[model samples]
Target: MTAASRGILRVVDSDAAEAERNADARSESQSAKDTAQLVELSKSGDREAFDRLVRVTHRDAYALALRLTGNAEDARDVVQDAYLRAYKGIDRFRGDAQFSTWLYRIVANCSNTHLSRRQRQRHDTLSIHTELIDTRPEHDPALQGDRAELRVRLDEAIRKLPERLRSVVVLRDVYDLPHEAIAAELGISVTAAKVRLHRARRRLREQVLPMPGEVPRP
Candidate 1:
């Protein structure tokens, strides 16, 4: 072979070797290895392994659901439903992403489904948080109490937002997902995600924090 052709072949081989090394490194990471083992076991009908997987991820799932649904009962229901779906779908799971990421997507889908059903049924008219927020004395001196009150108000404000706006806000702001990722997860265009996020923020600010020159409610 000519010297020029030999050099090009060596460079291509070097790139391939580097790529293989990187892939190996990723596959060997402790978390990835453990997740792979758990996934394999779960796929083989090992109920205990699947339970462990759910246990590790349930808190995060519940937190996401709570943000999306704004009601503890609804959030619990969504998480439970998501877990049941996951258990059924585990064998079909592809390892292209972390199990947690896949699970979060399921939770997001379930959250969206629950919100849609609630809106359709008009069953979200009564908010359980109302009494909780109303009875908390605004003058509570404890720092922790003030923070708790603020959280409740913020959550209530989010809960009252329109469903589309609420989903965008919770996924982007509460969950800290980037706009593009949020779009993909929610199955919307990136531009739509940004617009929804902007609207959601505006609504949240108007409701949770008073606008300039507006009197604050007691």
Candidate 2:
């Protein structure tokens, strides 16, 4: 082909690829918007709309719970509780944040309850995680055993944290609650929330960061 003709063909190919990407991005954006509308409808007492919302968001909600609780069983429970709480509190959910964010907050609260009770847990957390990893679809089958150990180690690290510090860290960083909100939740000053979060991070960094192997993180 002539040099100019070849160059023109390359530009056209590039433009076509760019347009395709843009179209795909727009499609994703529109899907997200539709989901948001479904959330609103669910809030307004539409049962089918809420069911569609669950179908769209349940996986993500479970992931959020898994990350927060570090045990699949606990994660499942947390996710279920979160959805129930979300449904009951739907009217209280102002339009300030994304519906997913609201769900995350509920999951986080549920996780905190579980995490705190973990101290008194009857069964071994590590063993539960091991069994869970064995069945998890996301992990490589070969690496599941090793990854479960890592997750246990992480749970150990978090468990080592003081309850006050742990609560703040989980709420602020894990669940992405603001300091002010955390303060309100914990009945502390915002300054106290910030201090506890800082303390929690420092301890986790010093303790968990230097661990020899990769730990399955939340």
Candidate 3:
């Protein structure tokens, strides 16, 4: 390369390196600030600070609830219920874990309670399946019919998953929670969380992938 070209390349590389370092530093600083401020505000009974926390964490919380409940309305209800409980119990928060971690625990507990109540109600009524199927949206005629068909297939696959495996897979894959956070939320050991997640993924693969003699069509 010419001397001028070499000089330009060196400058570009140095600039890129500096930019990456700055980004890393900024990320660390933001993390520290969020943690410190949240802890202080929560301890001081600052409702607005807690509201800010909700605004930041709500999307992830809702997504996790959606995956667990497998329905938008139920998920919304679960998240709302969880947040209410959290608000009432904030003073009891010991700060032993990250605030998000504590929130996840509340979310999980709320979802579980909702699901248990649903199961009990279903057992008492013969019309439970009718009610669930009735809640599903009608497909629009503008879309290809296959889109609706595929959605039904995917929902069935998820519904077939065992509870423990489903929870891990939903939290890890669907909500993108870290394994450690998932374990803490679920009150399981990290190794157990990993194993459950592995099994859940394997089961999902088996359901999605074609078996021998069943070639997947494009």
For TM-score, the strongest prediction is 1
Q: Tell me how candidate 2 scores on lDDT.
A: 0.72
Specify the poorest-scoring 10-residue window by lDDT in model 3.
Answer: 127-136
Ranking of predictions according to TM-score = 1, 3, 2
Which window of 10 residues has the lowest lDDT sum in candidate 1? 133-142
Model 1 / residue 203 / CA error / Å: 2.1
Which rank order by lDDT, best down to worst?
1, 2, 3
Q: Which residue segments of model 2 deviate by more than 4 Å? A: 1-25, 117-171, 185-188, 207-218
Candidate 3, residues 113-158: lDDT per residue as tens digits?
A: 7877887776423223322321112422223347766566555555
In order, what lDDT does every prediction score? Answer: 0.78, 0.72, 0.72
Displacement of the residue 167 alpha carbon in candidate 2, Å: 5.1
TM-score of 1: 0.65
lDDT of 3: 0.72
Clashing pairs in 2: none
Provide TM-scores for the models.
0.65, 0.61, 0.62
Output the lDDT of residue 139, model 3.
Answer: 29
Worst 10-residue lDDT window for candidate 2 reads: 127-136
